[model samples]
Structure formats: structure tokens, C-alpha cells
Target: MTHADTPAVQGGPELAQERRLVTEIPGPRSRELAARKDAAVTRAVGTMLPVYTVAAGGGVVVDVDGNSLIDLGSGIAVTTVGNANPCVSAAVAEQAAAFTHTCFMITPYDGYVRVAEELARLTPGQHEKRSALFNSGAEAVENAVKIARAHTKRQAVVAFDHAYHGRTNLTMALTAKNMPYKHGFGPFAAEVYRAPMSYPFRDAGVDGPAAARRAIDVIEKQVGATNLAAVVIEPIQGEGGFVEPAPGFLPALLDWCRANDVVFIADEVQTGFARTGDMFACDHEGVVPDLIVTAKGIAGGLPLAAVTGRAEIMDAPHVGGLGGTYGGNPIACAAALAVIETIETDGLVDRARAIGKTMLDRLTALQADDPRVGDVRGRGAMVAVELVQAGTTEPDAALTARIAAAAHAQGLVVLTCGTWGNVLRFLPPLTIPDHLLAEAFDLLAQIIKES
Candidate 1:
């Protein structure tokens, strides 16, 4: 469906899009909900900020007790267009009123096809492409691997250190971290190999080409290119902290993949949409992946994921081989369609770049003052500051936690990531007001200084 034919977007709840704390961060009502959650919710299902949210829009999340916290996390980069986005909510409501789900596999729908078309058009490529929708980023990554293996008739997959694909058995194998995501989740899927990552902050004096060579060497020696089905990577590592690969790293890697007949997969789950200024993080370097897995921000805040790629590769699987019971649900498809329209009509890509400049400028200044902030990195709205010991690169995870807790207490929502858990990542919605962004950063700066 064309943008011109799209219907009007609905408005969100009547909450002032500014941060306000009438009480403590969680307040009374939220604590009550938390108590109830403890009684009912499983301990394995963890929460970052445990405040029970009543409403959220623009740049703030309002808890049940009426505290408006500045939302820098954006629900872990899922709400790039903002929480309860008008366009997406309206589409979802309309789709619900019409029909919730027909199960795209059993009965196809226009919304699903439209979403696939949009993914093909928007993802980084001019080549003929196709897409298959799923329920989560993990599902997309898994499906992408299936397609790759089927297309190449190869068994091996190459992932990188400091990479986070997902939580499924196969994805857990792809993921590098061990403590929470992989620990105790033993007997993971095999044929997945981990290579060195281009962490510029940690690997000083290592240029992009050198980093690429190091990873290529491992891939060639350990997992022969002929045996590898695909080389999957997050252009900017997400849960492992927003580690942007060096300048020439991605191009060199893509070139090697091309020459080696290995399908190159770019997992843009956290960096897709306008989160990285460009539609896809790979676009920054004009590197096109054979398959691009996207989720997170695809459907505003709905559960939707997709694998868009070269038509021939995607078509490798026979008919009825690539679908799920709830994959490409009509409501999710509607929301995704609306999200694509919102990003284009609202100029969110440019907005993300502006937000990045604002954040980088402020955080760079903060790093100048604080020796504990070892590195400030990331692109567009997906930014982070890695904390370390003064004058050294040793990660200070305790200090990072303290600063995050302090920010939460003061009604600011922040998230910590990185392999060592010392990176404070900020991912504000593209619709966030500049003033709120500035205020939240100021609050963070004050809290860091106090710590």
C-alpha cells in the first residue's frame, strides 16, 4: 500500500510528553504491582526497570503512580517511532476490529504481503529481494540460518565475539556472552563458530582492515569458507554493547564472503529502522548483506520480525517450508506497515541523525570530564558510553550499575550492556523532544559525577 493511501493515525493517551516525578521512581502503585508480579511472574523473566507502566508516549513512560521517567532505553530499541505510536496503534486497532489473525500460512492477507514488500523496498539493497515474517528477532535469525543452509547446502555458520543474535538454541550458540544468556543453557546447536570482533576501544592501534584480516584468518583456518553456509553478524553489536565495527571492517568481510561463496547475513535487529540514522546499519558503509534480519523497531512495539534477502536465496526453501503459526499476524503486519509509513513521512531517519549529534556532543563532553568513562561510541540514536577504571581500560561494572540505579532513582530510564556489563546504552525514540533528551543527559551527567 502506498503512503498516500494510508489512513489517519490515532492519538495516544493524554499524558504530557515531559518527565515529571510526583513521587519516587516506582512510587506506591508500581511497588504494589511489583509485589503482585513477584507472586505471579517467573524469576527467569527479568526486567530492567521494574516500574509498572500505565502509559507511555513520545519520550516518557508514565508509571501507575504517575511518575514520568525519561525513556532513553526505548524498550531496548523496539520503539524507534515511540511507544504507542499514533500510526501504529491506529493500524493495530483497526486490524483488531476487522480481524485479529487468519494465520498467514492458512489464509494469506494483504497486510503481510505489504509488510514484506516494504521490507524489500526499505532494507539496504537494489537487488530483487523477498521477505518472510516471524514473531521475534530470534525467529528471524533462526529462519535466516535455515534459508542460508538450504541455499548453500553447507552446514557451518560463523558468528563473532561480542555478538548477540538471540536466545534460541541456535542463536544462543551464535551469541558470545556466557553469564546470563548462555550459562546453564548447555548443549546448544553445533556448527556455529565464534571469531574475533573489531572492538576499536579495546583493540587500540588495530585499524579496520587489520581487524577484518584477523577475523578472516580465523574463518579461513577454523571454518573453511566452502563449509560455511553463512557469516552472520550484527553491524553494531546490540546486547553486547553498541560496538560499531571499524571503518573498512565490514566491506572487507563482505568482499571475502562474496569471494568465498558464503551467504553474508547482517542481523539488524537492534540497528535497523532509523536507529542508526540509515535504514540499516550496513548502509553506513554501503555494504549489502545477502540476507538482513530485522525486528525490534519493525512494528512500532508489536512482536514482528522479518528476514529480507536476495529472492533466489530466500526461494531456496520449497513452498510451505518457511512459515509459522503466528508469523506475519495481520495486526502485526498492519502495525509494521504503519511504522514504515511513519518513518518515511515523519523523516525519522534524519531525526535519528540529529539525535545522534545531540547525544554524541553531550556524551563526548561528559567523557572529557569523567575518567571512568572509557569510550563513547555508537551511531545515530543507538549510542553508549563504556565505563572503566580511571586511566585504564578495565571495565567497572559495579560503577556502571551504581550510575544506572542512581539514574533510575532520579526518574531516568537507562540500560547497561556489554560483555563485561559496563556499557550504559541510550536508545531514545526518534520522536523524543530535544529538550527531554538534553534534560535526561544532564541528569545522567550529574548522577555520574556524584557517583
Candidate 2:
């Protein structure tokens, strides 16, 4: 399907209906819906903000209550091309109309192969590569580890502290946080180790190279490079305060992995698909990871994930060892193809860089004005502001909560994450209108100033 054929972007009248709101946030209608959800859905199912969105397009979410909230968090970085992106919608619809599911494992489809080819083309590195699709980020991560183990004949997987991988047993073991994600879900998969991440804001005196050395020292001493199959990292820590490693940190780590024969896995689930300005955050540092795990924005809101890596390593897994029933569903594959095409043709990668520049400038100004703002960090559009107390670096979770609540009350949707739960992350669609982004930032500034 071509963009010219999509109603949402073809200058059709329906474009106007895409973002219209008819009620207050979680309005009476949404409340009624939420009540039904509570009765039918599992209690464990969670929500960050209370507003119930009935429709989303471009950079705004229209709630059931008729509130048009500016979406700063792209469904936690899932809707990079924008919610209900026309290109992606058309592809999905067309594929669904043709064939919803054939269980790729049973009978292959062109969409799956096309998506794999696109992943190889778009992911960083110029080496021969291969890709396998999966149903979710966690599944992708798990399979990456499996491939790493099969290739290296190693047992252990090393991950950084304060990382958020996934919810499955293996991924939960790989994840760093305890509460909410792993509080009661104990007895996780073993042979997984954690090392300190380079958090520049708190590690004041430590420079980037020094931070890398410190982390490397721990990994070498505790886990020993030989037993490790892979060292997985979020190029920019996503749920961990959007932390970007020091300048030489990633390169140094990659070099170490190369030397020690450990597969360097870049978990680009949140930072890929031009969300981080670059097509992938590793591109910023010129670091070519051995295996790259991607999801989130890849399918423009569908459940799709992929592990793209060196052909040799990816092919190490025996046939039938790395597929899921719904891995790369045709509908999702079509959407992913459209997403990749849209990012490139629409110049969203450069747009993400421009968006990041604007966000960083505004956020830095906010930091200067507010002593409570401890740090403004990230690359491209994957930006974050860490909140601290008045005169110290003490995390102010309460203030963060207050600011987020205040912003939401005023019609801007923001997300907060971090080990201390004191960081505010901005994940607006790269395609968000300039005026909406500026207004959202201005509202955030106002809330910070008032607080």
C-alpha cells in the first residue's frame, strides 16, 4: 500500500476525525469503559495515566471523555511514526484483508521475509546480517541471548544495572528493577548478572572513560568475560532515566566484547526506529553491535519484535529453535515495512534529531531555571529530565509525581521512570507538530516553575 492510497494522509476528510475529542479525560463514557475493563481484565494489568484514550493520531490522544491530550509519551515510545500512522494503517489493513495469519512457521509469507530484509538494512553495521522476528521485545531479547549462547557456547548473560528488559522469566531475570516488575515474580532465570551502568548525573567526578573502566572492571572480575554469552545494554537506558553512557563508554564496551568474544547486544527496543534521532542509538557512537534487539516502534503499534545480528551468529541457532507462533504476523510485517519506508521517505530520522535539539534546548533552559532539575540528558528525541531536591542531588520522586500530575491536568501527558522514580521522560512522536511540542514544553516549564 502506498501513502497516496491511505485516507489519513491522502488529504481525505477523515484526517480531521483522526484527532477529534468528544469528552473530558476518562470522561463519563471512559469511566464506564474503565469499570468494564476492571471487571473483565486481570487486576495485574496496569496503566500509567488515568485518561482512557479512544483514539490517537499524529501526536495527540483523544480520550473517551472528549479530551484532546498532547501525547508526550508515544505509548511509551511505541508509536514513533505517530499513532494510527496512515502508511502503517493502510499496510496493516491491506495485509489483514488478504491474510491475517498463516503462522509463518507453517507456511511462509512475503511480508515476513520483507520485514527481515528491512531490519538487516536499517539496523547499524555494514556486515552480513540475518534477522528473526518475534512477538514482543522480551521474546526478542530472550532469543538474542539464545543465539549468543549457541554461537559462543557460553552460559551467562550480562546486563547492566537499572535496566528494563521484559517480563518473561528469562527477561525478568535480566531486568534490574525489583518493585512492580519483579517484586513478587521471583525465582527468575539464573546465570544472569548485572553490572553498574554509567550514570553521569550521579557519578559527578567520574568521566565517561573512567565510568566504562569501572563497569568493565566489575564485569571482568565478577562474571569473567569467558563465561558470558552476551552483554545486553539499552544504547540509552530507557526505563532507567533515559541515561546515555559517557562518550567512550559504549565504544569501549564494544571493544571489550570483541576482544573477549562476548556478543554485544544492543537492546534498541525503545531507542530504535529513529526515536533516538539516529536510526539506532548505536549509530551515534559508531558502535556496531553483534546482535540488535528491536520492537516498540517497529510495527507502528503491533506486537512485533526482531533480533538482527551478524549472519554467522544468527544462523547458529538450529532450525525451529527460534520461532514463535505469531512471530512476524503478516499484518504486523506489512506495518513494519511501511514504518521503515515512512521513517526513511518522511525523513523522520533527521526529524528526530531536530526534535531532540528543540527538546534539549528547552529542557536545559528548564534545568537552569529550576534548581530542582538535576540533569537534562539523552540524544535525538529520546530525552529526559532528572528531578532532584532543592539544593542536593537527592531524588525527588514526590516532586516528579506532582509535576507529571500537574502537566496531565493541563492536557499534556508525560511519563516518569527511574530507579528512584524521579525522572521525567519526553517521548513525543518525532512527527509531532512543532507548536504542540513547544506548547507541551512550555506547560512543563510552567508546572516546574509553580512547583
Candidate 3:
């Protein structure tokens, strides 16, 4: 039978379930490969799974050992459209066969313009918009800060605590974590400030509006609104613990930014591209950011990033200041166009919302059974469950690690994040079959219960 005609063993979407495993977790070959990887790779480049994949498509990662493990992390929310999605693969292959690079600033190309047009149309806000392409999320964020500073003619850039923008010098200054990401890498860029974020799970007494006011007050008192170029935030804090802001917090902050002449930026690198229910998390609050920084899933696994914002604000930077040598590589641009098309044609946005509902339903039930699960929160397929010590609100990092190890031992991959490192995040592909999703949750629940 043709691949399409073959019934999926997992049984949900025929195409998705067609992928399957043929060996035990990490099997024999993957163990050998892991040993080789240990020898060649630097210790700094940390890996969560022991298995190395030989192929990936749809919702499964086929390891070199012949095991098809269900993908739930989506490469830290980078492969939302799916691994080796047909449309993205075709576009990249076609572009590779043709001219690969001319550097948009050096020669220019239609693919770059097409990708920019798509960003302008998709990003939040009804105002006239423009876009600048980059190679990574850190680059987009760094440039956004540059644009905001130029437009407002201000020096200080404000970011939220627990934010994970990027790892570049400026972005490292912007990021909040101190462990692996920011360990000894200091001497970051200057004129960067941090404000408290609305973390409801931890700050129980402070409501959404109150949290926004407190954060704004700090900005006004320390940096002063007039001296601030931009106030950047991730709507639902990723890496920091899938923390969704309390209702009205974002809108309140947006209003404050508008009144103070501070450019508001939404760092949608993790939450954008339908990873959240909406196209952008800003849509949930009807908040229009002056700039939106995006990457991760923008090119369906290829490296491409962008900054979409109000036309005037985006145009404030000098012409020569915006681009880079390989910002919009032809292959990445082609893949991005196809990624957006697939997101639209395959209805992945709606699928993201549906996936969130299923995950919430299952996780909520699991939460009811396990006291270790302190909270369940997130939008669309970007869901998380924060673990706590039984009968207390204290973070249970040890238990969280055990639960993740247990799941991985069962051939299911998972991820952990949070300032306290007690959050278990689920970033399953939107195209994952319902059966596989159910199986993943079942495995997770079993592990959590046993742990």
C-alpha cells in the first residue's frame, strides 16, 4: 500500500500516525551515537534526550536506532508547523537548487519582500506596518531596541523579569535567567532595565491590574517614561514558566506605554506563529505593540527572524543600520513563505487552539489527582504544568526532574523551564495525531502519579 493508504498504528490522522517506532527507548544505535556526540560536542551545548534522530516528519522523530518517538517539545517551540513539513521542505529544496544567497541588502530578492509582506499582514494591529528580517530572535530583538531608541530618541530599554529574549550580548542583558544562559557571560550591553512581571501563580495577592501598575511605577520612578525607549515583554512568559499574565495586565501596560511615549514591544518569538491560540498573543488582550519580535517557527525549522511594527517606528532606524549579511537567506525565506501558507492551508492556528483544549482537559484532570502539579497554564499548544512540593507552594525542582526523566525513559520527550526550574512545558506539534497526543498525556500522567 502507498504511505497515504496505510492505516496509522496510533490511529488519529492517517498521515500523522503513519509514523511509528521499531525499537526500545534510545535503542542500541542511539546509545552508540550519544557516546560519539559526547566526544565531539561541547559540554555547553546541553541535550535533553539521549537519542539522535535520523529523520523527522509530521509528529514523530525517527531516531538512528529505529525508534519513532512522539515529539512534544517541538524543538522548544520551533517546529510548530511540523518537522520536515512537505510545503516547507519543497520550498527550501527548490530555492537551494536555484540561487541560495545574494544578501538582500547587497542584491535584493522577491522572496525577502514576500516574507516581509506576510509578516505585515499577520502581526497584530491595524496600523500601517513594516518588517525587517534577521537570522535569529536575538538579532530581531536587538534591532527592535535600536529602532525604538532611534524613534523615541531615548537611551533606556525596559524588559520584564523572567524574560528569555535571546543569548546575544544585548539580549543576554535583556534575559533574566542566570544559570546556563547567563552564567559567566556578563559585561552585557548597557542602558537596559528590568521590571517585575505578573506571575499569578506565585504572586497570589497582586491582581493583574495591580501588577501592571507596580511594574509601570518602577519604570516611571527609576528610568522615567521620558527617558525610556521601549518596554518589552513576552505576553505569556515562555522559558520563565508558561506564566500567563493576569487579565487586564497587558492592556494596562499598553495604555501606560501609549501615554508615556514608550514604544511597547511584544517578544513573540516563542508565543507567535499559532503556538498560542491566536496569531500573536497580543491579540488576546487587543494590545497593539509598537513592535513585535518573532522567530523560532517562522521558517518551519530554518533560521529566520523578523521585527514587525508600525511603519513609522520601524522606519526610524537609518537605512544602513537594519540588515545583515545573511538576515534573509533565500532558502530560509522560501521556507518561511511555505510555512505561513501551510499554517493557513492546514488550519494550524485553529488546530493549535484545539490542541490546547485537549491538553488543558487532560492536565487539569491530572492536576486534580497530583498535588505536585501546582498550576496548569498556557495558550494553544504552548501549555505548561508547574510542579510544587506536595501540600505546599514551594517549587519541586527535584520532583520535576524525576517526572521528566520518567517520561523520557518511556520514549516520550518533555521539557522543563521556569525561574525555579519546576515547570514541565508541552509544545507538541499542531499536526500531531489525536491518538499520539492522548498517549503522550497518558504517559505523562502515569509518570507524574508514580513520581
Write down the TM-score for model 2. 0.95
Q: TM-score of each candidate?
A: 0.97, 0.95, 0.95
Higher TM-score: candidate 1 or 2?
1
Ranking of all candidate structures by their TM-score, best first? 1, 3, 2
lDDT of each: 0.92, 0.87, 0.88
The total number of steric clashes, by the backbone 3 Å criterion, in model 1 comes to 0
Q: With candidate 3 superimposed using the best TM-score fit, by how many Å does residue 207's alpha carbon deviate from the native? A: 1.9
Residue 8 in candidate 3, Cα distance off native in Å: 20
Q: For model 1, which pairs clash?
A: none
RMSD of each: 5.1, 4.2, 4.0
For candidate 3, the per-residue lDDT at 139 reads 95
What range of 10 consecutive residues in model 2 has the weakest lDDT sum? 5-14
Q: How big is the RMSD of model 1?
A: 5.1
